[model samples]
Target chain A: MAICTGCSLLCEDIVASFENGSLKHAKNLCRKGHGHFQAAFTERTRPMIDGEQVTIDKAVERAAEILKSAKSPLLYGWSNCTEEAQSEGIALAEKLGATAEATIACTTSFCEGILMERVLSGKIETCTLDDVRNYADTSIFWGSDPSSSHPRHLSRFSYYPRGEKRQRSYEEERTCIAVDVRRSPTAQLCSNYYFRLPPGGDLPFMEAILAVLDGKIPKVADKKKMIELATVLKKTEWGAIFPGPGLIYSLQDKMELFEQLLARLNEITPFKVVPMVADCNARGFNELLFEKTGHASSVSFNGGSAAYGPEHSVLAAAKKCDAVLAIGSDPLSELPIGTARALAHQPIIAIDPRRSLTTDAAKVVIPSALIGLEAGGTAVRMDGVKIKFEPVMNSELLTDEQILARIMEAV
Target chain B: MVSAMEIYMLLPKTNCKKCGVATCMAFAVGLLGRQKKVDECTPLIEEKKYEAKLKKLREVMAPIEKASETGLIIHPEKCFGCGNCVVACPVNVAAEPTRTAVGLGPEGEKVILRVEDGVVVVNNLKECKRFGPSGTLCNACTATCPSKAIEFV
Candidate 1:
């Protein structure tokens, strides 16, 4: 059995079989995981420098030279890499006196927020997926569609399985609610319980919930529904709210409202919040960086200490830095087109296992072995659960950790 | 699933507004959503000429067994093709020749559930392990379905 690093779920029960030099079949893989596994056989990257094929040694040397000589360099894209590789990446950033940021930094300014601070300080309540399965009676998908994102979320933990306590499961016991702007797939599953708010209406929605909890009439168009929802919350024995990008992006600077809501709900019953981080190890990177430094998302070590701000973010660093060393992530395809264009102007050293838009545009590309399938490593799941796995197959390619160590050695 | 045309055929083509709807076609559309019942039409129910049509309409529009006594019953309309069942099923996962094969093609067929267009399709029902005489009742796919599309009967 092998783990699939396709998304943040990091599904660990994958049964993969290989024939000759290609992937033969894989079971227990979502569509995203299936695509990720198929990526190994199709459009595999080769060692290249200046659009010319070269040896892995030559590519690393070029990448090292670029990082060593460049002034105001930036190390980006650590969310997809292992915790070990991320640590090495942080060391490389410190060595070059450069700024380092991941894709998570672009979503919300989690660094300065009370949310990240509370998570780091362990002030806010959090529970694992197992806890959700066992104890939770109310599972709220606030702006997060686990059906499309974490496919097995309902089956494995949230809504479906018959836990020790939740023997009746979703039919008689569990209540699944979706608070989203549009009727997403998960919202559709919520059936009559879906709360449809307008875009950027999360603040008012939260205020309405708080109002209903306070026994005041909400000023929304649907006052009765809000009261019903509040009634459900008030009666919940154990509830968990999974906030996705929609909620985070909608509640940007007003995250205090979410905290207030959580606090208010806790007054009635036990409630926990688990952020719906996207990438497999985004939370891992955040936790690792927070452990090393005080900040959670973006930081710079140029002035002999860790400095973090919006200016040090990937978007800001993209314009200021002369060169960028992106690993395990394809920012060109993932980031906004303008940001991608700005980063495209600079000399990029892309270290990845597969060919992507970032790898296509990089001045230096060093191919590495695919994690989980071809290289053994440790990764943190979205819930901060540490999962260790061994390689499912043997590969001649070097792992990201080995490649980053080589680059550090060359520099 | 009964088609709108099938329901439309049973409706009296009077284009009457007595049912509050503008046309028989509109009434048939409402019947699909359970919004308008076949007996809602005053002329159809009261008039002896439309008795046969009304009887057939009621039979066709009647709710079927969404959940069975055993096995799985998938409501394709509710399935958003998330492929949760495809991955969560132990039977699909334990199948041989594990490589990455996507789409509805026959080669490298690993998963029993396939998402076509935007709905979940049971591609290989024969490969389902629950069908054998062992009476092994595995609803892993049905249990994990977030959309509640899969019903274990």
Candidate 2:
């Protein structure tokens, strides 16, 4: 069996067959996972230096030399890598991040960093995906569309299947509610239970729920539907809230309100929060970074002292740093265009198995083996479950850990 | 799924009992239930004036002709192998007692549907609820499919 690294769900029971560096046949894969499995055969990256083909050793040396000489270096993009690779990245960050102007950040700093701080600090309660499948009765998707993002979420964990306590399943026992800014595919499945919130209106929506729980009139346009939503919440045996980037960005510094809402719901019934994180091991990096440092992301180390703030974020670091090392992430296509322009101007060292915009424009590119299919390590699920995986096929390319460790030695 | 009313709209409304059914509506219903073939209606097939209606009706009911004995068609291209149908089907829930009900992939030969090669495939059509006289119009698999990949005709 193989685990798919396409998303944070980390679907474990994949039956795959590989021949001659390509996917021969696979079963139990979602559309995303199928594409991810097929990606290993397309657009394979090679070692390059300044757009010229080079040996792997030369590329590593150039990457190390560029970072060693930079006044401010930013080490970024560790979400798609394994926990072992991320640990090496952190060690490298500790070496260079201790420079007067160096910083370390990940893809989560853009959205999930602030919210992950709440989860890792015990401010919000989270559970394993297995527990959700076995016990959860009410699933509230707040600005999260698992159908388009995590395809197997509903069938494997959230709603569709019969659980230990929810043997009746979605027919009668399980109730799904979607709260989003627009009618997503998940919202359409919710039908009447979908509650549309305006952009940046998550706070008001939370207040309305609190009002209905307190038996007071809500300030929204529809009060009956609000009360009906409240009744669903009140009658929940065990509830889980799946927050996405929408809710995190909307709430921003006011994420304390979300914690208060969770606490209030727990007063009446049990509730858990699991942010719908993207990528394979984004939650893993956040948890590991949180374990080493109190803060999850956007931290800069100056003279061996770790400092945390927005000044150290990838967006801000893009302007501050003169060198970058992007592993397993494509910030050029993913970040704001302005940040991409800034990072594109700087000398970037990209380490990836696939060719992307970031790799296309990098000063140095060192290819690594694909994680789940070609190499194996542990990853954390979106719900904080640690799942260990093994490589399903053979590959001659080095893993991310070896590449990062070689660069650290060169530095 | 093509509806009875949809099939009824494409038939010849001449009310000519040449097909042995009392009314054209009953013939349309029989054609949908597979009790009467589309060629049984002589006016629609033989009469040149109603040739277009016969062609349109054939096009409409093409899915039913190719469907399994249970009148079910699962489009593999649209499926992501989430196993929603394997777990939602009542017959599968009773056959494969382990793994499928708690929301895991269904294994073994007792199951009616299994996800292979990243798509759901029919494993046992005989076990489907719509197979025999005891079969009812059970749509648990079609209704629960989020991708709308499973269809009943």
Candidate 3:
């Protein structure tokens, strides 16, 4: 079986057939994952410096040289790489006395890292998506639209599948509710269960739900709708809330209210909270950072000491650092225009398998092998499930682990 | 696609310089092209039929046409007394409020930060290192802005 690192699902059920060193067929791959797997054969980047192709060794050498000569270097983008590679990256950061951050800093600053860190440390109750598939009777998509992001979310895990306990399947056992600002694809699928709220209205909506749970009137223009939704929550046997970027971005400082609601819901019945991270290893990145230096996302190793705080985040550290080594992420396309331009002007080292806006302008580009397919290691699924895998194909390209290791060796 | 001449014939054609353009016809053309919004035409919506046409035209140009990969939408109604997006925008694409409008969502609702044009301007001007750049419409700055102003459309 092959693992698909296309998204945070980290689906371990992929089946691929290679013939004459080319892909023959692939099964159980979603359109997005299929694009990811197929990406191995197209738009592959070569080792380059100053927009000129160079040998892999030269690229690695140049990357090391840049980092070694830098005063404050920022090492970012490990969410798409393997755990082994991430370990090497941490070692490199420590050796170079640089700040080690991940794609989470950019995403979680507005999303769920703070909430997830607490949840992971046992501040709240949660479960794997597998548990949701088999056990959950109610699934609430708050500010998450998995229909567009994770196309196979419903059919493979949440709504459609008939798991060990859900013999009756989605026909009678499961209910999917969507709470979003707009009428999204998932909201349309949810039909009557959809709760459409205005922008930045998540806090008030949560309060209304809390009121309904408290057996009091909800403070909203549509109190009857709130009452009906509250009734659904009160009767849920097993429920799960999937918080996405929309909810996280809107309620930046109000995550405590969400935690309180979860606490309140637990009193009525069993409930769990699951965060929707963008990358496959967002959870893995958090867990690895936590286990290494007792930090979840941001950590600065300047002067050979690990100092961690929100200010050490990539968004916070990008401008402060003199040079940045972006691995497996395209910050130029993923950050705000100002932040993108700020980091772009620095001595940027982009390590990616394909061409991106960052690679186009990078001072050094060291192309690495794609994880989960060309390379093999472990990655944490979105729900904190640790999954291991082996490489499904062979190529001359070095894995991110090998490259980072080489850089560490050079340094 | 209403002609600029018909647009001029229908409304007061205030020829007000407030819309930036010299004539309401130019403003109408700008509005149709998303270069300008009907709300910019202070007098265009004063007449009942012109207002009805503006409302209908705004509906025809609902939110999806303006959606970028990041799924951010600008709320015109919610966006007032706040110029945070202008400062929060890294590429400075949204620096000019007059050119901004609701990207993808309801009519007369949700103002996009003009990141599309900003991306173009940044590239054209070759303004490097002003803010962090990403492959997608990154809301990192907006995410960190003290004002909770940026929203996904």
Give the number of the best model, judged by DockQ.
2
Model 2 residue A218 distance off true place after TM-score fit, in angstroms:
1.1
- Order candidates by DockQ, high to low: 2, 1, 3
Interface RMSD of 3: 17.8
DockQ, each predicted model: 0.10, 0.61, 0.01
**Alpha-carbon shift of residue A56 in model 2 (angstroms):** 1.2
Instruction: Kindly indicate the candidate among 2 and 3 with the higher lDDT.
Output: 2
Between candidates 1 and 2, the one scoring higher on DockQ is: 2
Tens digit per residue, CA lDDT, model 1, B1-153 = 677788899888889889899998998888775567676888889989989998888787654233222345678767644555664565554552232111111124655665543455665665676764654777767665666788643
- Residue A120, model 2: lDDT of 91
CAPRI classification of candidate 1: incorrect
Show model 2 residue runs off by greater than 4 Å.
B1-10, B47-53
Each candidate's interface RMSD (Å, one decimal) is 8.4, 1.6, 17.8
Please give the distance, in angstroms, between residue A174's alpha carbon in candidate 1 and its true position after superposition.
Answer: 0.6
Clashes (backbone N, CA, C under 3 Å), per candidate, total: 9, 0, 35
What is residue A125's positional error in candidate 3, in angstroms? 1.8
lDDT of 2 by residue, A54-169 (tens): 99999999999998888889888999999999999988888886664678788889888788888899888988777888788899999898888998898889988887887888
- lDDT (tens digit, per residue) of candidate 1 on A1-411: 778888888877666788877777675565667777777787889999999999999999999999888877777777788888888887777776633322223222332233545666676788887788779999999889888887767656777555668766665798999988888878866787899988888999999999999999998998999999999999999999988877877666786788898899999999988788877777777787788777777777774577776677777878887888888778898888888899899999999988999999999999988887888888988777999888888899999999989988877
